[model samples]
Target: MDQYKLFLQRMGLIGTSTFLVTITGIMLLPILTQNLSIQDYGVWTQFQITITIIPAIAILGLPYTMVRFLSASKSRTEIQEAFYSILFTVIFASIMGAVALYILVVPISHVLFNGNVGVGLILPLTVIMSALQLVFVDYFRASNQMTKYAVFTTLQAYMVVIFALLLVLMGRGVVGAVTGILITQTLISLIMFTFVLKQIGFKIPRFHNLRQYLTFGLPTIPSNASFWVLDASDRYIIGIVLGITSVSYYSAGYTISSLLTILTSPIYTVLLPILSQFYAERKIRETRFLLNYAIKLYLIVAVPAVIGLSILARPLLYILSTPTLANQGYLITPILATGGLFFGLYCIITQIIVMERKTKITGNIWAISAILNIILDVTFGYFLGIIGIAIITLLLYLTAFLITVYYSLNYIRCDFYVKFAKKTIYAAFFMALSLILLNPYGPVNIVLSGLFSFALYIFVLWLLKGIKTDEIKFFTGMIKESLVNVYCALRGL
Candidate 1:
């Protein structure tokens, strides 16, 4: 129980951070969509997708490797060597990636950036800084420094949003937004590097563990690339097939749907390091327990979120973006929300494969799924437009979830709490029905209806006994303890 509480506390910290970031995104979405032209927004979206993919490829999954190996290390010397070795390797690879991006800037600008040479030129530097930022941030995760991790994560989001909004408001447009990102990345990287250096001290690594780290981390590159394909390739396909304007519509919908990730992201962040520690100690039962409960907790939030977001998609999008975007992109939300739910589940379950160090299997699964996703994206995107892309994405996520479940079970069994899931769905159905009857139109009504609907859902779930007393007590206790900690910190200051 104590261990579970500790896990929840850490998760809550990161979860709070993620929630703030999500709110920042929600606030920024309107500002960007309203301020920028649809075509320019599409360019911005393309730039984001490109940066995400490049860093995922360039960092070589070494950050995660650090989490896996360093979670259990107590030796300061050993930690120093592994950290420096991985950091240096990632830096070298990222620079090489930046050079490659610079060399290929012209064609990439044409294909993705809509021939914006300035954004293309800025891309290489952004990729390098972004890659370094990733490594530095994961250093905290590797060391179980959730407070620092959460603070930096939230800080970076706000910084980027503020900088970009200021630049865009000054009539700098998509290029300004891209430049804002580069500036924020560079500053955050420097800050994080300084803090981490102070904590771990500096060491010149012998690269003794470099081979082992690569052996573990390299296979995950395919998985990471495949994931980017599943998640972001649709933008490219839509941009190519329909037009950059259409990409804006698709991306707007995708952004609204990705709210589900706010629930899953913290779980992934907190789960990995702790799970690594448990697996290293051969605590299989604890590992299974944690995984099972994590999925259940995620579903508790996510199941209703999917339904609520789908039901409120139009109003939410209308409030956040233009009416035209709301109308064209609203349908994409339900499909993507459902798909995101499945993908979130896959992320939690696939930890078992990671624990077993069978990263090759994970890579194989995503590699196959990515190929299928692209083929479907081209066919369906051309014929059925963005809706078809959404449907295929849902199918791919579901397939991945099913396949991962199969492979994951071979190593450790986890209960998915089918009855609890049914209750959640039942509660969500009623919430959706209420939302439909109310028919929220504007931002204020939408906010009210959303709050009322969520409260009602909780009430209904409680009546159905889906939420047990002990579970409620546990979370409330954790919250109270967190409040006390905050109060003490403030008092100290």
Candidate 2:
């Protein structure tokens, strides 16, 4: 029961945070669709990628390493020291990056964006603001306060959307939308810095241990860069090889898929700390147990989620996007969802590798998968278009996930792995087949078919002795808890 509570807290806290962030972005999606041209949105996406990839480089992947230490260490001062060290590193790195950007944003933007140099400036500011936001978020999680973390996360995204809408309505154009993002992030960072200072009870950082942060964080740089490549390299390619319209279409697909990770990411956020502590304590059995259980739980929830989105892809796109994006968006949702499942698994396993102190393994896997993705995207996307990217992405991730799972199990031979993988395969195959059988009908009929598939899934699993009675009961309890949370969200509670 105690383990269950901890698991619930970990999942609920981060999951809820991601959920709110997704809701924030999704709510604002239609506004952007209506206001911005496909080319404009494409530029916005390129700007976003620049900001994100910049932090991965500038922060030197410290946020991820910090979480591991924060999770494992018992000393309050140690956590503080680690946090301070990383914060200092981020500060220096951001300064240097900003200078470099100021010098090159114009030329870089001109090349990638067809002589649109203003976006270069927008990208750097976004990076500074976003990097601060990232550090503060890690601060909150290190302090074990998920609620504050969620609030700041949702707040930044909401304010960005609101500012974007206001600017667009007032004829801000694409530049105006970019300004909205900048303003929103700037304000959020100020609030975050203030709160973090207060939370740790330090007026100024007292840590003399920059080496601590550097040693831990530097090794993750390769892994972090590779992940950026795996995920964003296609966007980079599309910008160079394909025109802005193609980039826009690909970005739209990436955006929809991103929703899945936005919700799933916080899982890694909380899990890292918790899992690291377990590993430090040599609680290997508990580590494997939690992972096994998490895999099963994710499938039970995620299978239905991706399928439903795929089924309603058309109407969802029509309702959410303008005529320009309606068809394109629909085609991308399911593929994104498929990619999302594999990405979620990667997130989970990467956390495991971190906990086990296998940084090189993580780095190598991401690098290889990234290279494969690039190859596949170019080779297939040339012929298949966006669908080619999705297919390639989905396949690469699947291969990476299977490799992660295999090595992770070999790292610690445990019985639960076999059991967990069996059940996961059982559920996933069952669910995938269910989606296919339900594919031929109209949307409403498909939904009904999905319902029937779900029932069939449960029945088939039970008949085959895949999941036990108590397991079913536990799942039902979780569903009820989730629904209650949903109710609270609806009532504005």
Best candidate according to TM-score: 1
Those runs of model 1 whose alpha carbons end farther than 4 Å from true positions after fitting are 477-493
**lDDT tens readout by residue for model 2, 84-200:** 778877878887898888888778887665567766777777777777778888777766666666667767877888898998899877788888889998998888888776756
How many steric clashes between backbone atoms does each model show? 0, 0
Which number leads on lDDT? 1
Worst 10 residues of 1 by lDDT: 484-493
Quote each prediction's TM-score.
0.97, 0.87
Stretches of model 2 off by over 4 angstroms after superposition: 203-208, 225-227, 414-493
Where is the poorest 10-residue window by lDDT in model 2?
413-422
